[model samples]
Target: MIKSLLIANRGEIACRIIRTARAMGVRTVAVYADADAKALHVRMADDAVHIGQSPAAESYLVGERIIAAAKQTGAEAIHPGYGFLSENAAFAQAVIDAGLVWVGPKPASINAMGLKDAAKALMAEAGVPVTPGYMGEDQSDERLKAEADAIGYPVLIKAVAGGGGKGMRKVDAEGDFLSSLESCRREARASFGNDVVLIEKFILSPRHIEVQVFGDSQGNVVHLFERDCSLQRRHQKVIEEAPAPGMNEATREAICAAAVKAAQAVNYEGAGTIEFIADASEGLRADRTWFMEMNTRLQVEHPVTEEITGVDLVEWQLRVASGEPIPLRQEELSIDGHAMEVRLYAEDPASGFLPSTGRLDRLAFGDATRIETGVEEGGQVSPFYDPMIAKVVCHGEDREAAIDALIDSLADTEVWPVRTNAGFLVRALDAEDFRKADLDTSFIERHGDDLIPSGEADDAIWSVAAQIAAGDDQDELVGFRLNAPARHAVWLSHRGEGRLIDLAEAEAIAFEDDGDLLSAVDTTATAYADGDRVVVFSDGVGYAFDTAVRGSGQGSAADGAIFAPMPGKVIAVDVAEGDSVAEGQRLLVLEAMKMEHAMTAPFAGTVKSLTVAAGQQVEVESLLVEIEPDEG
Candidate 1:
């Protein structure tokens, strides 16, 4: 019996584990870094221990330090919730060596499935179908490229240690293989700290179907069915659901069987997910599927699995580690309802999906099916970790009802100050391709522009803001005093557009503009005017802005176009004094909140002047890189 458990990760997953463990009468310990001191996960746990500094390499990645914290806190088991050091074989072994129950798969199992090539080989040896690829001992780039050539174009050059699509790239043709290979290697090295890569035959228009497999120390392994995660961007799963839609009874059993076989081959114990990419173009076929990789810990999208199967995977992990048999057998398990989980990230979708960082001034997501989060209002979204804020999951009797609940939950969520992907998810759900069940991994890429869910406010909101600026209160009924001024100019800035509206105040301003009836619902209100703008407070955080257009051109120089790539402090300037440079040349590295972003040139040109010096904190669109027009 595990009495206490320490979660070795942060964010929503940590909060999720704590919720389940506490319900099972188990105490939870949360470990946080410098950046996550005031995080909600830390607040939700029974006990929290500060490990080290903010950077992951110095804090969360320190496996030995985490083990020490667990031992010191007397936590009987350590759960490496998903990311960070969850997949590290050494970390699991260290937890076992520290005389604490490791609430995860055996370290040998982690080592077995950690590498894509090794996992594929092991799956093949265990009679599980494997994808055709170069999973040999050869690390030669030439051999890999040759293998890709033989396999055919549209091959996938993926990192052996890749998950979350960080170290993966799709090569459409032979001409672009090497370049994509280089990019994949760079991203893989940066994300996973491992550069080993493998090439696999790319199944075009495929559906990412994965199975949820759970095992115990008693040699019992069973799957909780499948999840279809084909909706992705850059190979990172955005939406996932259990009992994968469109899968037939026979195909579902076969796929789950394969997943169980893959897990059993490693003698795996505890919660693990075996991901298999199935060719949904031909529907679900046993021969058309291939072994992808096995995640050796609880999944980020585990809520959907719990929703349909009615199982708490984290509790099962605790119970299994406590030397209990698997919760249920194949005969007892059944999918009850349709469920969906959407990753709500603190990022600006209109800005090329750039990570948005700021204090969450106001955060409120009303009671939905389930809102799992690890941050609250006043919590900062640091660049040190993943930018995901919460996972909003909703379940219903069927897929359509589930989708409707999910859409409604998003509309009801109000997160101000920091931008989010909520609007984009809403638009995605409303898309024709999605509504009609026409989805794939390429869904986001193909329909991304059409679904341009932006941060820019619409014209109607600006009109309302302008009305509020000119003493228009939506919540008050004001009688028109004939002695006062009959007309006033109302100005507002919205979506970067200057809006100027002349309003005549009255008991009811009876007018029509742009098919919108102008009616003043309230007038008795206090308005605080700041410069040319004012906010009419009403309802909650209600701000109606009216402002005059400050028409000014900054500069016609190349400075207008070239800007800093990310929010990083400038480390070193690579160009100065009108130096000539070619395309893709590095200009300066901006080190923001901490990560380094090298601002580069898009074309060959001579540097006119460097606007910023070394060690400057720059925003994303700030002027940084400057270059003259290239001469013939």
Candidate 2:
């Protein structure tokens, strides 16, 4: 095995690799940007090195800096954990040329699958079933529109070099094809530096199923079953499970076989995933499943596959990189039990899932089966990286048991000040369609109204907050003989709305603090209190309330002022000063955390002030534009 390894990544994935390397007695080196100086991954590694500034472009994406850091620390191998340089073939070759083992697939395999158009062509030549699409090298708009017409309506326009849901657009009719193509091309050029695209027939009911495959330097390959990632939002996966809920033995065998064939065609090494798009308008039929693309490194959801296969995939990556054969053959591997994983992100579902960033004043996940996180209680959720805080994973004897356990685990989640999608995930898991396994890529979009929380604190939650506010005083007043009124009022404010609750009328509430989380004794409600602020958690949603006495005053609206929702760079400014616009006209676009958000006019008006322009970085709540409403 390799003696010392350097992880060229950050967050939970880096920490995960450190765990396995340490258990195997291999020393680990971690590289961090300025923002991650006190990060959990840096603390966990045997040695740490500062690369550059906070932004990824200046730090993590600089391959030469990473290679130099590895040499400075005398690392024998470099493991690019998933995101930063994991799929960069040039970086992989550079590491190997520098005499350090690259714990990933060969650079040749990465180059072969780097672009979707060429990869699909290769898959077809290798006798693998690929989706019907246009992958030709004609970069003319006329050719793309003509191909879309030939493929039929509802075709998917995807960037040739895209992943993580960027640079992809779905057009439902001919009239929208040109505009959607333009938008897709612009985003593609901005994100991947490649605006070329391909067209494919969109499946009406698509289910994303991917098989985990491993290979060795000795030309041996094996698969570790499949995972169902049908639950998605904005083309990004929110939840994933192993051994797909409704997959039969025949479909399983066929999909797994094709995955092995695809891996062998590339002479793959280490861990890789073969993703397939299944048309589930019927069920999971082998003929309906087609190759989507290949992820040339470890995946974010690899933990669920590990749970069901009893395998440590990171350990396998290390051993294979050291010239060992794959640990198991295809026939020797089998699924053990059901497992599920949910990504806990620092985003607010009520605000259209905008990323939330701040110091994690109080963060706790109680008694979860397994948790993979990079931030602690006092760490910060910076705007410079992915907003995911942790990944919650659980295992059970069967699918039903797994779902039940996962629900319980999510209910115990407690976060405050920085909002999260925990409540949204809980509702998604407990939905009737999800529980019945009636899943698809449109699950969240179709059921969004029912899944998102109302952002209101109910009477039960307010009562719990009141109990905490009246702490110890209520206990002392028990059995008082003198002039104690039947009810005492407690003044509180929630979301800027004030209310007075009668302490005597409140239902008997109890609380217990277990050093990690504050829970209502004998109830499912959880709460946290710091000074005058209290946050009550129900169904994994935190509702913050102020305990100080205050008059009932409504909050003022922004009227015509548009503020930056989060810290981001202004990508486009469509309007100018004195420009007349309609109520919903596009004003500008902001890019943050690898996503674009368009700001629109709140009402019909003339632009009075335009303080921002393209390529300017703005902080949270900074004034960007102001509109003066049209005179009556």
Candidate 3:
């Protein structure tokens, strides 16, 4: 095995790799940007190197800096953990040329599977069933539109080099094909620097099932079964599980065999995943499943596979890179039990899932089976990086037990100030449809009303907040009797709504001594107080109320002033000063955390001032535009 390893990534994945490396008695080196100087991954590594500024373009994506850091730290090998140069063929070649072991597939293998259009052709030749799509080299507008029309009414236009749900669009009708294609191409060019695209017939009921395949330098390949990743929102995976709920033995065998064959065709080495899209309108079947793409590196949901199979994928990657044959035969690996994983992100579900960035005043996940995280209680969620804070995983003897364990773990999650999707996750896991395994890519979209929290504090939440605001002083009450109680009113506000809660002094003290008021009312609710402010957490959503005075919260969009939700660069400006605009008209686009958000006019009004321009970077709450509302 290699003596020392250099991790060319940051956040939870880096920390995860470091833990496994240390157990093998190998020294580890970590690379960090300006925003991650004090990150948990940096502190956990044996040695650290400062790469560059906060922006990923200035640091993590710079291959030369990572290579230099490996050399400086005397690391014999480099592990590109998941993101940032993980699948870059040229970077893989460069590492090999520099006489360092690259803990991934060879350059040729990565190149073979990098582009979707080319990979589908390769998989088809390998006898793997591929989706029916148009992968022709023609890039004309008329050609793509013609192909979409030929395929069917609903078609998918995917960027040949796209991943992570970016650079993709679903065209529902012929009239919207060209506009959707333009938007998809623009996003693809901005993200992948390639405007080439492929067309596919969109499946009405699709389920994302991917098989984990491993290959050795000795030309042996074996699959570790399949994972169900159909639970998604905005094309990004929210929940994943192993041993799909409705999969039968024959269907599983066929898909797993096809995955192994695809890997063999590339002469693949190390760890990789063959992702297939299944038409689940009638249930999983061999004939209905088809190859979508191949991720030529470790995946974000690999832990679910690891839980079901008693194998350490990272260790296998290390042993394979060090010239070892396949450790286990196809028959040796068997699914032990069912496992599930949920991504706990630092985003607000109430406000359209906008990324939340600030100090983690309070963060706790009590007694979870396994938690992969990179931020501590006081750490910051910078606007420069991905907003995912942690991954909560659980395992059980069966699927229902695993789901129940996960729900219990999520209910115990406590995060203050920074919003999270904990409540939303619980609701998704406990829904009747989810319990019945009625899953698809559109699960979140179809049940959004039942999933997303209302963000309004109920009576139980207000009662808890009032008790916390009362403090521990009993002498402050006018009529403090041992038997009877003195009534007192506490004023509070949430999201600009004010409420006056009346509770007896004795009742408040009695509940406080019992220490189960919130739990009795709502099992998922908890309360915390900071100075004069109290925040009640229910179903993983934190509803903060000001205890000092009513109506002290921030103003809303009714004033016609639009502020930047977070620090980001203005990528597009669609309106000029004094321009008349209608409500909901797109005014500008802000790019942050590798995603684009459009700012729109809140009301029908005239542009009073345009304070920002394209290419300018602004901080949070910085006014970007002000409009003068029209008279009624």
Candidate 4:
């Protein structure tokens, strides 16, 4: 085995690689950008090196810097963990040329599946079932439109080199084709530096199921079964599971077999995933499933597969890269049980799933089957990277038990101040449709409102907040009116809304310390006092309220000013000063965490001042534009 390995990535994957490498007695080197100097992965590694500045293009994505860091640290191999340079064919070749073992497939395999159009053509030639689409060399708009017209309405316009749902558009009719095509191409160029695209017939009810495949340097390949990644939002997977629910023996065998075939066709090596899109309008069947794409590296959801198959994929990658044969064959590998994984992101579901950044004041989780995370309490979730805080995984004898265990695990998860999808995930797992496995890519969208209800505090919550404000002086009777029979009030703010609760009239009260429940209500709600804010963990969600008197807290921004919802770079300013605009008109676009978010006008108005320009970085709540409300 390789003695020392360099992880060419950051965040959870880097930390994950470090765990397995150290366990195998391999020294590990972690490379970090300036922003990740204090990251958890850096502390876990045997040695650390600074690559470049905070921006990925200046650091993680720079192949030369990574190579230099590996050589300086005397790393015998480099593991491109999931992202950054993981799928870059040239980077793999460069590493091999430097006489360092690349813990991945040969460069040829990466190139074969790098672009969607080319990869689809290759898969077709290899006899892997592929979706019907246009993969021609025609770049003319008319030809592309004709192809889409032939493919029929509701076609998908996807970037040839895109991943993570970027540079993809679904056009339902000819009227929207041109505009959608332009938008898709623009995003494609921005994301992948390639404007080429491919059009596919969009499946009405698509389910994303990917098979985990591994190959050794000796030209042996095997699969670790399949995972259902159908639960998605914005085309990005939110949750994933192994031994796909509702999968029959026939469909499972066919999908797994196709995955193995695809891997062998390219003479694949190391760990890779073959993703398929199944038209579930008629349920999962071999013929309904078609090759969507292949991930040429370890995936973010690899843990679920590990849980079900009792395999350490990272260890397999190391051994294979060291010239070992495949550890298990198709007949030897079999699923043990059901497993589920949910990505706990630092994002607010109520705020359109916008990325949130802050110091993690409190972060905790249950005794999950496995938990992979890169941040701890007091850790900074910087705006410079993906907002995923942790990935929680659980396993059980079957799918229902796994779901039940996952829900309890989420309930045990506690996060404060920094918003999360914990509450949402629990609801999603507990949903009647979800429990029955009625899943698809549109699951989140179909039940978004129910999953992400308005963060309104109930009376019981207010009662708890009021007790915390009174402090630990239980000797003094809270809200005891000595003079007259009048109700005493306490002011609290929650979810940007303030409330004045009459403490003396509260129905029930509760206060606890160190898991002790002291209340009339028969419920356990853990709460603690943090400065002027009272933090509480109740019913699978975390809440914090500022103890303020009425009229003292900060109010919303001025009526006409458009505040930056989060810190990001201004990518586009659509209107000039004095331009008339209607309500909800897109005025500016901000790029943060590699995602574009549009800022729209709150009401019909004339632009009074446009203070920001393209390429300027703005902090959260910084005023970028101000409009004069139209005097109708």
Winner by TM-score: 2
Please write out the lDDT profile of model 1 over residues 51-170, one tens digit for every residue: 999999999999988998898898999989988888888888888888999889999999998788888888999999988888876868788889999999889988988877679888
Tens-place lDDT per residue, model 3, 299-389, is 9999999999989899998899999987999999999889999999988787688887767888988456689998999998888887889
* Model 1 stretches astray by more than 4 angstroms: 178-195, 466-485, 502-632
| Candidate 4 regions with alpha-carbon error over 4 angstroms | 477-491, 495-512, 515-524, 548-632
Please provide, for model 4 over 183-246, each residue's C-alpha lDDT reduced to its tens digit, 9 standing for 90 to 100.
9999999988999999999999999999999998787889999999999989888999998988
Give per-residue CA lDDT, model 2, range 527-606, as digits (tens): 76778777788888887767753222232224787877666789999999999999999999998767898999999999
- Residue-level error in angstroms, candidate 3, position 258: 0.3
The C-alpha local distance difference test score for the whole of candidate 4 amounts to: 0.86
lDDT for each candidate structure: 0.76, 0.89, 0.87, 0.86
- In model 2, the worst 10-residue window by lDDT is 549-558
* Worst-scoring 10-residue span by lDDT in model 4: 515-524
Model 2 gets an lDDT of 0.89
Off by over 4 Å in 3: 477-486, 505-523, 549-632
User: Which residue pairs clash in candidate 3?
Assistant: 423-539
Per-residue lDDT for 367 in model 1? 49
Candidates 1 and 4 compared by lDDT, better number: 4
- In model 2, the Cα lDDT at residue 570 comes to 95
How do the predictions measure up, each by TM-score?
A: 0.81, 0.88, 0.87, 0.86
Task: Please give the lDDT score at residue 371 for candidate 1.
Answer: 86
**Better TM-score candidate (2, 3):** 2
Instruction: Count clashing pairs, candidate 3.
Output: 1
Model 1, residue 36: displacement in angstroms?
1.4
